[model samples]
Target: MTDQKKAKKKALKDSQLIVRIAGSERDRFVSLCDTLDTSAAREIRRFIRGFLKEHDDQLDGQ
Candidate 1:
């Protein structure tokens, strides 16, 4: 494909992070997980997406 397509592919692959939350935090995470009805990975991804949408520009200048 094109350079832009290749960049997009790389970006998608690079856009994931692995996190370890403590047990107390995990209890909260699992509560949100159940509310979202998704695996922990997905719930975290959804939260990050919404967070970034709301604060990306503000965050970038920090």
Candidate 2:
């Protein structure tokens, strides 16, 4: 397999996550994301990946 194909497979988003936040906060966040030409889901995924990288050691037990 080529490197590009391997990367495509690795990048698959095959999961669901549910989060609850105050309705007003969620509305504002979504509006900001739209203004930045991105979706809330995309930002959340980026945040999750960054957070995981930052605290990976703390998650080793899980």
Candidate 3:
């Protein structure tokens, strides 16, 4: 197998989230993830970072 195949296979293995997307949305998200070659953990971290940046101040007071 080549590098791209290896990377995708590793991604399938390493991802931990059981995201329950279905049909076209599932295909679209998987394709987008594949294009980015990004791990699920990394994606979640990025999401959290963005969320924090947008809402950390509100969170602190609560």
lDDT of each: 0.82, 0.94, 0.77
lDDT of 2 at 37: 100
Model 3 TM-score is 0.50
Q: Residue by residue across 1-62, what tens digits does model 3's lDDT show?
A: 99999999898667455666668876776678879997655776689789999998899877
Model 2: per-residue Cα lDDT over 17-38, one tens digit each? 9898999999999999999999
lDDT of 1: 0.82
List candidate 1 segments past 4 Å from native. 1-11, 31-36, 59-62
Lowest summed lDDT across 10 adjacent residues in model 1 is found at: 12-21
* Candidates ranked, most accurate by TM-score first: 2, 3, 1
Tens digits of per-residue lDDT for model 1, 1-62:
99999999788767657677798999987888789778877766778889999988998878
Which of the two, 2 or 3, has more lDDT?
2
Instruction: Flag clash pairs in model 1.
Output: none
Clashing residue pairs in all predictions, respectively, total: 0, 0, 0
TM-score (all chains, Cα) for each model: 0.48, 0.74, 0.50
For model 3, where is the 10-residue window of minimal lDDT?
12-21
Error of 1 at 53 (Å): 0.5
- Model 1 TM-score is 0.48
